[model samples]
Target chain A: MDVIAGLGQGFLVALDPINLLYCFIGVFIGTLVGVLPGIGPVSAMSLLLPVTLSGTPESGIIMMAGIYYGSMYGGSTTAVLVNIPGEAASVVTCIDGHEMAKRGRAGPALGIAALGSFVAGTFSIVALMLVAPALSRVAVAFGPPEYFSLMVLGLSILSFLTQGSMAKALLMAAVGVVIGLIGLDQINAMPRLTFDRLELVDGIGLIPVVMGLFGVAEILTNIEQQIRRDIVQSRIGSLWPSKEDLKASAGPVARGTVLGFLLGILPGGGAVISSFASYAIEKKLSRTPERFGKGAIEGVAGPESANNAAAGGAFIPLMTLGIPPNVVMALLLGAFVIHGLQPGPLMMSQNPQIFWGIVASMYVGNIMLLVLNMPLIGMWVQVLKAPYKILFPLILMFCIVGVFASGNAVFDVFVMIGTGVLGYLMRKFGYEAAPLVLAFVLGPMLENNLRKSLILSEGTFDIFVVRPISLVCLLIAAALLIAPLLPALRKKREKVALDATD
Target chain B: MMLRRAEFWGGLFWLAIGAFVAWQGWLLELGTLREPGSGFVFFWLGLIIVAFATSIAIGGLRGEGPLLGDLWRGARWRNVLLVVLALIAFGFMFERLGFVICSLALLLFLMTVVDPVRPTISIPVSLIAAVGVWYVLEKMLLVQLPKGTWVEDFIPF
Candidate 1:
């Protein structure tokens, strides 16, 4: 009854003319970024974090959330038409989607992707609505030790899942935490790594770091290589899938949605992993597995659905526990903080309007994306035609402007440049930045909880072990951290990484 | 051989950083575990970083990674160098020359020197983007941007 009533109230907030406008803007820009390479939701969200300040908190958050899921939908367009994944999650789509395009089935390939994404997106939102409330209730009972242990588990899982050496991932996470802790100490108000600089007193701004690492670094990486686009030149005939095509898609869509939602809830799992896993599962399950890379409709249906569902599912931890599971969600957390709102256990009870409004607005945004993607495919193809040479310069300019506007200081701009170069170097050395960014966001909260638990326990480490939740979390983290040491487990991890790369 | 490996140099860079962080933490004073001080987490994290970095360096020492030159073997590295230098120049001149001038100069340089887009597309696009963004941020959003410390008197808005 409470859920229904809250949803009823949420629709009222979401249907507001102004909020509807913001939702449209969000999804529109989201699709644009998703269609373009060298820019993803992380860069887009950080770039617009300051713009969110102009409106009411609900409106801003509604827009930001739209960009994330909308990107999942737009990404497949580029993958299917151009054979280039616009964003990471769409990489699997390029395998069969472009193949279908080459085989003169571009219309049906696109049609199924859109339909599958819509189904999965709607399903995940419904699940998020149901699951987030129950999860928040459980999260309310969590203590400092529990929070600390959970964060450790999150970091450990991320390190374990990252490609290449686990040591590099762990080191990056550690470096992130140290950078995060550079400002004045939260407990005693004593400066640790400030080096007597006033800007350091506030610590590094998330916008600069994110923009530098993601936005600027992306440009640097892309410019170092020649990027080619091979758009399927054949005219797309009809977008509506044939009855047989729809029949083949239904099962994959259903399976992908369920699998994606579950994976999306995991700390280290998201749309990218969900999509890849779904593709592998579909290929394995098919009796005629030989058709997977040869333009199978199931290939187009499954991963597209899974990634969209995962985008929705990734919201669970952030909305309910105030812990962002991925880099994109971390940026969302930054948005919430900038708005003077905290999204956690108390959010549903205290700020029901905001919570429900965001939920309701997603339903509207999903529909908007469907309309935008279907008949307007030509517009996106035109956008794809814009040369990288022209785009990179404009993107670089935006990076500078966005960073400078974020903090209204030149120091922040320099920070973006420095990190941009560092990020470029890290990429060359095969270091993944996801763990580092996630750890940076979690560092302060993790430190605070650890200190609080210690104070509560009178310096005894028993506080962590005695608590059941903390103990379980710590045990899981320990297992993950140790799993890479075993030869068999190490091989499996490498195989998963290789599959992802492939 | 180890010195030519990319991971070896990367690990060594982080190892030095980890040591420096640990030294800084010690200087800041590590409080008791019960009453943890500001540097307590930092000190422990620094040691963890050092340990992890050592393993990575060892992996490199055993020749388990790509050679440093291989990272940029076939790439257009000159474009990257130009972009980086251009960004640094923009940063130095941003406040003194103002947002519009700096942006226009940076965009034009990128399109021209780095990749060489035609003048017809580059000139108008740079002008519109620089002026249009300034209008939106300054006039519509009311966010203040640098209006040239030196050229504020000379430029007419």
Candidate 2:
């Protein structure tokens, strides 16, 4: 009932030898993929999803969660050493981190990043412990209408912020919803898009789609370009930050933790936006703004802390409200559903061990990451030297085996291949897969809620606008939809004015 | 001329898909607003898709987009095609040829044909990886990977 008691029980679960082993494996693999350029946590998690099926739910979830945050720690390594960001969250780290590496301060830069990540990660877990229960209490009051509105707002924000054309992104979301409609109708139990195939009745398998889209598509994209990386040749100096360096970085790290935690609660692009925002804030606050691009410790400290904190904060919505704020959370949501556990307000009350065990594991995982990364930095660098040609075939094997073993259906394999090709084309055309995946996951819930709300209102279209929370969500969705168009409309009006003057 | 652009073609493809879904939803009978039917959401989603695709098509009509050919500009089509074919063949023969033989062949082809490592290296590596993965999945994880219909009859392992 109390936070302390819950955490005490959680530590008991997390400390169990099996869960600890899985956590270590997760973070270790996370760091490996995070150091390597092409593969990411999403692919790693998806590949391991089936394997975790054999383990207890606590161990399975602990492993997956470890991969999510562990990658955040490992991403900085490549950014500091090779100037290639292992993940999108690490992009900002490349700016000052690589510069520090060039200046022979790579060790301190990396040391500060790990230290900052540990502090922010632990801070976020404490924050999560404090905040999640309260939020779930509030979320318990929500009805179907509120859920419908929330999903609408979530999808709109996701599509609006996705890189490239908003129209294209929205179109992809629509496509995803359509694809999700393939299974037997939830209400009547009649197949909608099965086309007489029995497998379609169960719907398109999520594992196959994810593995195909993120895993296979990535490999296809990477092989298009020649694989080459230039490792930083200079000696990595001492792995400790000096007193002056720590003092200089403390302020940025604190600010980044607060900013990242707040931003990570939002629906779309939170981690990325927070990292960039933290960098901008630090640069603005700096007396020596000119020093930012040239090996400034603050640059490395702020964004690294922000991204790690953001990863932790992103778990809140999924845990409390049953809404995933990002793609990684979406996969975790799938994992929860696979384990026959529904994550919502009731989850905290019903499954305290699972809820708190994962929370406690973050504490263990963060400490493990610090220990793993600091002494084993050279080993991670050695992992980066593994050739892409050799690595890819192994990755491909994992994808195939993972999918086949999970479902025991060859049809799923075909689905993966088809989606993989579609994913590849989508990437080449500049359409992002995040919105699509998120929309697909949310589609069934959205439709079910919409129908329920309509039935409650007795066919009146006024139900959505009549409810205050629903009205606010719809209004926000409308704003996000129109927000992207304003800039384009303004540009057209400006062009018209210039033409008239000419 | 607009159709020469990748965006235009993509938009058209989505438009066709939208139209088809809308037609299917209609046939499923779009229920009244009071108690929505299964088709009600699909119908509206289809319409929304159509609207978005139409707008994309209009933008593409300006003919200021990358050509369709640009999609494969730097791709090694030969390698890509080989990998796809290998996967399809593997999936096709998974149960018939068994996990070990099919996976080994797939790896050998990828290493030797698509990317072209020497046989001396590709042979042992493929054998180890294929057998190693089978042991892990089937034996350790207790997943039921296919044991090959024909090959199992002979080897009986």
What is the per-residue lDDT of model 1 for residues A1-502, given as tens digits with 9 covering 90 to 100? 2889989999999999999999999999899999998899999888888888899999999999999998888899999999889889999999999999999999999999999999999999999999999999999999999999989988898898888889999999999999888898998889879989998998899999999898888899999999999989999879999999999999999999999988888887889988888999999999999999999999989999999999999899999989898999999999999989998898999899999999999999999999999999999999999999999999888888888888899999999999999899999999988999999999999999999999999999999999999999999999999998899999999998898788
Can you give the TM-score per candidate against the true fold?
0.99, 0.96
**fnat, candidate 1?**
0.90
Scanning candidate 1 chain B in windows of ten residues, the lowest lDDT window is B33-42
The DockQ score of candidate 1 comes to 0.89
Instruction: Give model 2's DockQ, 2 decimals.
Output: 0.72
Best by DockQ: 1
Note the Cα lDDT for every prediction shown.
0.92, 0.86
Off by over 4 Å in 2: A488-502, B118-120
- Could you tell me the fnat of model 2? 0.64
The per-prediction CA RMSD against the true structure, in angstroms, equals: 0.9, 3.8
Q: Candidate 2, chain A: TM-score?
A: 0.95
